[model samples]
Target: MGDVWAAGDAYEDYVGRWSRRVAVPFLRWLDVPAGKRWVDVGCGTGALTSAVLAWKDPAQVIGVDTSEGFLARARAQVSDTRASFRTGDARSLPLPDRRFDAVVSGLALNFVPEPHLAVAEFGRVAAKGGTVAAYVWDYGEGMAMMRYFWDAATALDPAAAELDEDRRFPLCRPEPLHQLWADTGLDEIAVEPIEVATVFADFDDYWRPFLGGQGPAPGYATSLDKEHRHALRDLLSTRLPTAPDGSIALTARAWAVRGVAGRPA
Candidate 1:
């Protein structure tokens, strides 16, 4: 199944909001020093880029994405003069090699058609001793938000299993990520989990984002007919736990990996 990432506002509504929660801690895990140049590959809506600007105090950040719509919104949201948004592919970034102190992507690597090539590109643009890091939702289980939805959808329609992110993105897990870094020749490789709370005001707060059709789950949702969509929604509502205030609280976990960009031998 193809991943949808065309609209910025729709993306922000779907998963970008939660992505922000993971950014600060992801950057903290890297612990890169301030005033260093950074490149945010697949920097959709500027979530990670904004986090670096606010928390890491980077000298400059270039946010790249294939979608011009995402870049436009990122440019609008990030008013900082030090930040710039561009349209570029992850496998072949449009920038000079060995120029950045750090290269990072949030919730993006798995969406790349050839993640290994993208990882190499990240390594290519990073200076020696610079950090290369990325994080992706653990769609197999830890990402409760989509997990619940997919579980319900698959139960209702076994065909939905084909579209599940868990089945589609095996690289999101820790072991595979470690192997990727190792294969890329990056040194000091490490992987960890980052989880955040996602509390929705009500079922609608949780359900409305699915209608945005900007990601895998949403794409699956919008693909269904009205009757099937309603059935899936009803099934999810029954499965999820709601509080006294009719709010739903779930945890979203992402697998994060980092490594030092080694100098060419």
Candidate 2:
């Protein structure tokens, strides 16, 4: 089954919350100067765009995404005069070349059909000496919340492995991330891990969002019959570590890559 991207609110509940957290350290890592132009490619819900506006005090932040639902939510939430949302593809951006001082994407690179083309576009739009960066979940290991869920899920139904993001996206890893930037002729390449704490008051706080059907795991979840779904849920409940306060605390890690842009490969 294909992933869902049109339900902005549902996505917000799923990964947008964590993406916002990732955006903070991500911008700090870029260390771009104030009043620079920025492009948030695959800028879903304006999380990174809002971060640019709030943190970098940019001259402008142009956010591009394919989903109108996400752009609408972004437009509504990020009313800052410096930020604007547009519908566009990552592989073929409508932006002019070498116009942005900082080009960044958050939790979005892996979702691109051809992420290398998207990276090339990122390099194309970024000004000489400008920074190009993006982040994606470490779904195979470090993303604890999803890690636990997937572990519990695959155990219950081996077929679920086909939809598992860990197996699906190899580029989310650090080595591949660095190679992609290097192949694009981006210099000063670096890949760092950004982790955020995801604490759920109870299993329900974590479980209900899976029912929203906004992403791969959630989409896979809602596809199951009632019995199979409940079986998966029960399996997760038994497996996840629960604190005495009844909270389920987990960490989500995303691999972030950055480089200086100018040359093309």
Candidate 3:
């Protein structure tokens, strides 16, 4: 299954809206002072970047992503003069060291091949005492939306288990995340669960995004043959807990981690 983030609008529809809910509390957790320079790594569709610009009042916000399509959409959606978008690797940020007062990423860390290296890079670009933070869905259990999808998918096809984010991204857990921060020499490292309500008006509202094939679950769904795909959909339809009015309400939880960049010894 292709996990590449090539489509902007599809992603925005699928996870970007839910991610914005997490971004607000995640930024509040950081509690950084206003007017500080910031860098948003993997700033997909500018959700986190836009929130930072609107709420934090940063002096400047540089948003970086590997996908040019995402960057283009970010630039178009976020018209603030203080915000700029660039195409760059998160593992090796293009900006100079110790330039930004805060470096943060949202819903993007789990996609990185080497999360520890990416966290180290965040530390490298952050000024001493700057805040470095990131948040990712708890794919193993708490991220109910994808957890339910994967549970249904794996029940039908065992091979699909390998593609599951829970199995694929072990670093998404709090222990590994906290260890990575401590190992990087970051100070006051901490991890917390950020929960948000994912309310869908109807089953179609929930199922339509999966057909977009932008994220892992959607990609896997589209990769299957018509028969198996329909079977999986049928199974999910029966399994999901739908309210009396046919609305589906679920909780999505993400593990948010933060630390302060320490001065070089």
Going through the candidates in order, what is the number of backbone clashes in each? 0, 0, 0
Q: What's the true lDDT of residue 42 in model 2?
A: 85
List the candidates' TM-scores in order. 0.98, 0.98, 0.97
What stretches of model 1 exceed 4 Å from their correct place? 263-265
TM-score of 3: 0.97
Residue-level lDDT of model 3, residues 127-199, one tens digit each, is: 9989999998999988888988999999999999999999999988999989989998899999999999999
Question: Where is model 2 more than 4 Å wrong at Cα?
Answer: 263-265
Deviation in angstroms for 90 in model 3? 0.7
**Superposing every Cα of model 2 onto the true structure, what RMSD results?**
1.6
Top TM-score model = 1
Candidate 1 lDDT tens digits, 1-265: 5667889999998899999999989999999999999999999999999999999999999999999889988999999999998889999999998999999999999989899999999999999999999999999989998999999998999989899989999999999999999999999999999999999999999999999989989998998999999999999999899999999999999999999998657
Cα deviation of 212 in candidate 1 (Å)? 0.6
> Which tens-of-lDDT digit does each residue in 1-265 have in candidate 2?
9999888899998889889998999889989999899999988888888888888999999999999999999999998888888889999999998999998988888899899899999999999999999999999998888888888888988888888899999998999999999999999999999988998899898899899998899999999999999999999998888999889999999999999986544
lDDT leader:
1
